[model samples]
Target: MANLFLIVLAHVTVTAVVMLLWLARTYMKLKGELQVLKNSVQKNDQYLAGLSSSARAADSRLAFIDEQLKGLSAKLSAFQQNEQSANPYNAIIQKIRHGASVEELMRDCSLCRDEAVLLMRLHGSGPG
Candidate 1:
């Protein structure tokens, strides 16, 4: 009877030892997987942070471009206004805007007939 009890106890102890070893192996695998997941998350976070900063820099560049465009538009508007007020082309346009006829100005002016006609066309109003 004493020998039978010792044999049974020994079997139970061996079984318990095997179970502890299996649990330890499973715990190590789980810990390795958790570490890998944490590393992936950290890398993605760093990449996202860099991307956000780059986006902000791009936004600032776009704003600068927009300001330059507005300044150019203002200069263009001023140039067009000056053209309307100063150029010979503008004088011709204004004469044409008034009611004087191109043919009449050519006749009265001493310019050669063809030259008169050309000048009249250039600076005088259309026949009306």
Candidate 2:
């Protein structure tokens, strides 16, 4: 009968509408989740970039420190060479500190007795 057919048609239309609404809600939830994932990935990329920059800066500083140390080493070597060659008094002081007598200092260092006596009194470890 026509009445039976119309009742069946109305039930089908209501069921289809409910199915469509459920599908739309599911789509919205999936879209929100995708957005959250994208944001997390962007933050991770920024953090990695900052770490890379810091590592490069540290490497540069280390290189500068290495060059400064090399320069200081060279200057120290030159100063030592100059001191050894320029100062005979350094050797005389070593002899005096080792308890050399005035006579030995005068004979070996070509110093006058008065000068030898004065050095011994000033720098000798033992009795002058």
Candidate 3:
């Protein structure tokens, strides 16, 4: 009876030691993986800091470009308005320069296609 008890005790002790050894190895592997994760996190933090500042600078440049586009749009609109405003007087000036018969020009009073054609010819011919 005594010998059987001792044998059982020995078996339990050996099993416990094996379990402890496996748990210790698993703990070491997990600790190494945790260190690797910590290193990656640190590197990401530095990259983000640089990226954030560059993004701010890009936002500022975009604002300036937007302002320039708006100014260009306003100038284009004003130029169009001026062209329309000057059309009527410009047509009369062109007619006079054309030397279209004064009688015909006077009769039309409104001055018309004949004067414009004559004007283009006069301007295009030069000093005639």
Reference-based lDDT, each prediction:
0.76, 0.88, 0.74
Could you tell which candidate, 2 or 3, scores higher by lDDT? 2
Off by over 4 Å in 3: 83-111, 123-128
Q: After superposition, how far is residue 54 of candidate 2 from its true place, in Å?
A: 2.4
* 15-80 per-residue lDDT for model 2 (tens digits): 999999999999999999999999999999999999999999999999999999999999999998
The better candidate by TM-score, 2 or 3, is 3
Highest lDDT model number: 2
Q: Candidate 1: lDDT over CA atoms?
A: 0.76
Q: TM-score-based ranking, best first?
A: 3, 1, 2
Which segments of model 2 are wrong by more than 4 Å? 1-20, 88-120
Name the lDDT value of residue 106 in candidate 3.
48
Model 1 Cα lDDT, one tens digit per residue, 47-88: 999999999999999999999999999999999898877764
Query: lDDT (0-100) at residue 105 of candidate 1?
Result: 46
Query: CA lDDT of 80 in candidate 3?
Result: 77
Tens digits of per-residue lDDT for model 3, 15-101: 999999999999999999999999999999999989999999999999999999999999999987897686755654555566645
Q: Please list the Cα RMSD from the true structure of every candidate, rounded to 1 decimal place.
A: 7.7, 6.2, 6.5
